[model samples]
Target: MILKDIRNIYHSELDALFGKEEVDSFFNVLIEHYLNLKRIHLVLDPQYMITKEEEQPLFEALTHLKSQKPIQYILGETEFYGLPFKVNEHTLIPRPETEELVDWIINCHTERSQIVSKEPQTKILDIGTGTGCIAISLAKHLLNTKVSALDVSEEALVIAQQNAELNVVNVEFIHDDILNSRQTELVSVFHKYDVIVSNPPYVRNLEKAEIQPNVLDNEPHLALFVDDENPLQFYKAICEFAQINLKANGMLYFEINEYLGAEMIALLEGYGFKNIELKKDLYGKDRMVKGVK
Candidate 1:
């Protein structure tokens, strides 16, 4: 089949499930992923033919898309902060907003290095490190940095470890349940970190209706949700852990739920975290919060 015919098929099959623009985007991504051809290439060669073998997987993907499977999961990988990561149902696909969170941390550390005469080797830890996107990105960008990541799910950690190797960064992966453990239980493994970050399960059960079908049906709920009664559960636990594990003047960063910014600030203050700051993502929703120990 020719490029134009395939494009039409994609739109006709997926337009109702996803919008027109998104369907177009998905077709473009599949074309690029399967054929190594860009959208402009398709436009330039509208008569470009795809073999039966090549068309089979694209059709399968269309069926998956019709069932509301996320394109990232369909592809089994994604790019985050300019680095590639392997993702599966075991891990939450990294989002653009989380990339902004990584950028904020990298920029902050870069500025701090400029102010100091010599940049000290920094130890960084990422909690609930699904896919190891934040930890690996920080390690990839920052110089003289030692990065470690922790997650309760061993399945998620396996994918995270693969991502770290794929990105050629050395990130220590630990299997620990942060919610069930005490500070003393972690002290032996986690001595001190100059920067601690987590993009934990901030989406509450009540927010299920707000989530897209692709995420609600396919993604790991353990990494995506919190109890509605106590929405700040992970944030509170991590903050308390940071109190004992973070070095003096260490930084804590979180990608948060937009609705609970005020509650996040209050929780941080209550935990004795200083210099708290809230930042919005590209869409202007309050998505990131930072505090200092």
Candidate 2:
């Protein structure tokens, strides 16, 4: 079938599941993912055809979309900070909001270099570094930063290591549960860091009803949720780690739950962190918090 015909069918079929607007955009993006064609080509060459061979995967992708599976998972990879990273059920698909958190870290590094007169080589640690998106992106962009990442899941760390190699950036990936404070060990070579960043699991189980089924059912729950009994459990544990692990005047950054922004700020303040800042995402939702140790 011609590319145009396939897209038309895809749109109609997906529109029945997702809405017209979503299916239209989703089909175009997925086509680009599989074929490497630009959006303009997709529009101009609707009759552009795909073989029956290609149609099988396309059909499977459409079925997954109908089931509300995220397109990133369907593609088996995603672009973050302008770099390709592999992803699947093992990790959360890196979101644009987390990109903002990364940008803040880069800017902080730049500003510090200006003040210090020497180009500072920073020691940086990423906790819960699923798929290594945050750590790899930082290492790719932040020249002279010694980067390391930690995650509890060995399977997730495997994907994260592959992404680090794929991006051609050097990062030490350590497998350790951050929740287990006694067992969470830093790499001896890169011990204390000027910045510690985490986009840890902040979603409360009670909020699962509000999340899309694909995420709740397919994405790794160990990476997506916190105990409902104490929603800020990870935050508290990370803050405690930061207190002892961060250098004097070091910074800690977090991608937080929007509803828990004030609570997070209070939590950090309780830990004696100063210069606490709460920032919002593109959607104006509270999404990030930064504090000085």
lDDT against the true structure, each candidate:
0.91, 0.88
State the lDDT of candidate 1 residue by residue for 1-293, as single tens digits: 88789889888888887889999899989989988889899778879998999998899998899999999999999999999999999999999999999999999999999899677789998999999999999999999999989998999999999998898989988888778766336643636899999999999888899999889999999999999999998998898888888999999999999999999999999999899999999999999999999
Candidate 2 on 1-293: residue-level lDDT in tens? 77777777877777767788887788778777777777799567667777888777778898888788898899899899899999988898998999999999889888788778766679999999999999999999887889989988898999999999999999989988777877864443348889999999999989999998867878888888988889998889888888888999999999999999999999999999999999999999999999999
> What lDDT score goes with residue 157 in model 1?
95
Clash pairs, candidate 1, are: none
RMSD to true structure for each model, in Å: 1.5, 1.8
Q: Where does model 2 exceed 4 Å of error?
A: 42-46, 185-190
Model 2 RMSD, rounded to 1 decimal: 1.8
Best lDDT goes to which candidate?
A: 1
